[model samples]
Target: MPASLSKGGAARLALLLFLSLIVLVFAVASATAIGDYNIALTTVFLSVTNELGLTGADIPPIEQSVVWNLRLSRALIAALAGAGLALCGAILQALLRNALAEPFVLGVSAGASTGAVCVIVLGIGAGSLSLSLGAFAGAFAAFGLVALLSNGATSGPNHTILAGVAASQLFNALTSYIVTTSGNAQQARDVMFWLLGSFGGVRWPDFQLLLVVVLFALAVCILMARSLDAFTFGDEDAASLGVPVARIRLVLFAVTALLTATIVSMVGAIGFVGLVVPHAARYVVGPMHLRLLPASALTGAIFMVVADIVSRIIATQQTVPIGVVTALVGVPFFAIILYRARPQA
Candidate 1:
C-alpha cells in the first residue's frame, strides 16, 4: 500500500464507498419507481421481495412484471455495463499511459457497431448466433487488427492509438455504407437506436451475462493493481519493478476490448462512462488503481443508472436514447477536464 493511502485516507475511502453503495441502492429503487407504469416505492420493494420468495405481497401481475421483468432488469444492466466500461477505461489509461485512452480507443466500439449493423441491416449471421455474438466477433477482429498494426504492443501507445483511429474510420465508413444502402427505413431506425444505445428490451439474462463478465474482469484487474501502478511510471520503470510490461499490456488490452465489446453488443456505444468516470474517480481517490478501479466502477454505475432514469423522464411518449443522455452530459464534463488540465498561464 502507498503511504498516501494512510489510515485517514483509508477511512475516507471507506466512507465514500459506504455512501456510494447507499446511493446505488437508492438509485436502483428510484429507477424502478420511475417509468410509464409509475410504480410506487413500496410496491417496488414488495414486488422485489415477492419475486425473491421473501414475501407474499399480492401485487398485480402487470405491476409485478413491469417492476421485476422490465425496470429492474434494465437498471441492473445499465449498472453492470457502466461498471464494466469504467473499469475498462481505468485499465486502458494505465496500460497506455494516456489519460484520453478509453475502452473504445482501440476501435472496438466501431467494430462492434459495424458487426451489429451487419446483423440488423443485412441479416448476416442471423441463424446460429445473435446480434451480440456478431458484435463481439467484430470487436475482437478490430482489436486484433489494431494490435497487429501496432506490432503487438511493442511499438508505443501513440502507434496503437493511430492504428485504432484508422480502424475506427474504416469500420465507421462501412457502417455508414451499410445503413445508407440498406434502404429499409425500419432497419435504419433500429440500427440508429442501437448506435445511440438503449436498455428498453434488456432482461435478466442479459444482466446476468454482463454481471458474470464484469465480475470476472474486475477480479482480474484488482489482482493486477500493483503491476498497473508500476505501469504509471513508464515501461522501463514498470519492467524494472518486475512487471512483464509487454505481456501485461497485451493481456489488459485484450481484456478491455472484450469488456467493451460485450457491453457494446448489448447496449450500443454508450460513450463517456468509460472516458469520464475513471477521471472523476481519480479526482476523488487519486491515481492508485487499487482504489481507483472500484471507485470508478461505482461512480460509473451510479452515473449510468441516473442517465437511464433521466432518459426515461425526458420524454413521455418515447424514451430518449441512453447514448444521447450520456453524450449530452459527458461532452461538457470532458471539456471541463481538458480545460483544467491546460497549463496555467
Candidate 2:
C-alpha cells in the first residue's frame, strides 16, 4: 500500500477497465450473433475486428443481429447504468463532504421510489416513461429541498446532511403509506422490488435510451470534475480558487439527479454501484476526477457486469435483482473499507 504502488495499481486498473470495455463490446456482439450465452471472448474479438476497419471478412447475418440487435444494446445499457451511478455517488460525496453521501443513502432514491410507486399504484403514469418522469420529479424535489436548506448563512455539509436525512425519512413514510393503503399484495411487492433495484428484463431499445443518458451525464461530469476537485479543500477554499461553488453544485446536482432518475426508471433503482464503485476506484485510482471519472465509470461497469453474472449464475430461474446482489456483496467489502478508512479528496 505504498504511495507509489497505489499509483501503479490505479494505472493498471485503468488499463484493465479500458480493455474490459472493448471486451464487453465484443462479448455483447457475439451474444447477439449466436443467440447463445456461451460465446467466448476470442469469438467476440474476431467479430469486433471484422466490424472495425481491421482485418476480417464480412460478418454473417446472425452475427450482425447478435451484435447490433440484442446483446450489444443490453450490455452497454448495463455498463452505462453502472458508470452513471458511480459518478453520481462520487460527485455527491464531494458535495456533501461525507463518504456516505449517495442518492440512495441521502433519500434522493427514496423520493424517486415514492414518486414511481404513486404512478404504479394509482395508474397515474398512464403509460410511456411515466415511471421515469415521476422518479425524476421526485429526485428534483429532493434536490430542491437540499438546495433550499443549504442556501443560508448556516448552510454547510452538515446542514445538507441533516436536510437529506429528513427528506429520506419523509419520502419513505409517504411510500409506505401508499403501499399499505392500497392493500394490494402485488402493488406492495412491486414497490419493494423497485426499492431494492434491478436490471432485469432489459432489451435493445431500453439499452438505446440508457446510452443517450450515460453519455450526456458523463460528459457533464467530466466538464465539472475540476470544480469537484476544488471541493476537496472545502467550500471556502474552492470559492477562493475561482469556483462558483453553489452554482456548480446546482448544475451537477441536477445532472446527477436526472441521471439517477433515468437509470432508476430503466433498471429499477440499482444501488451501491454508485455508493461502492467510486470508493473502490478511489482506493486505487487518485482522487482527481480526471482520472477518477473514467476509472469510476470503468470500474463500475466491470463491477456491475460481474455482479450481473453472479446474479444470473445464482438464480432460481428468476434472476435476482442486480441491486440486491451488489448490496449483499458490497456489505462485506464496505465493512473492510470502514475499518481502515481515512480521509482523501
Highest TM-score: which candidate?
Answer: 1
lDDT of each: 0.90, 0.73
**What overall lDDT, based on C-alpha atoms, would model 2 receive against the true structure?**
0.73
Question: Which regions of candidate 2 deviate over 4 angstroms?
Answer: 1-17, 26-70, 152-154, 342-345
Best by lDDT: 1
Model 2: residue 201 alpha-carbon error in angstroms: 3.3
How does candidate 1 fare on TM-score? Answer: 0.96
What digit string (tens of lDDT, one per residue) describes model 1 on residues 97-197? Answer: 88888888999999999999989888997897799898898898899889888999687778989999999999999999999998499999999999999
Q: Please provide, for model 2 over 102-214, each residue's C-alpha lDDT reduced to its tens digit, 9 standing for 90 to 100.
A: 76655678778878888888777577657767877777677677667667323677887787788888888988898889739987887777777665556767777777888
TM per prediction: 0.96, 0.81
Candidate 2 least-lDDT 10 residues: 27-36
> What stretches of model 1 exceed 4 Å from their correct place?
1-5, 343-345
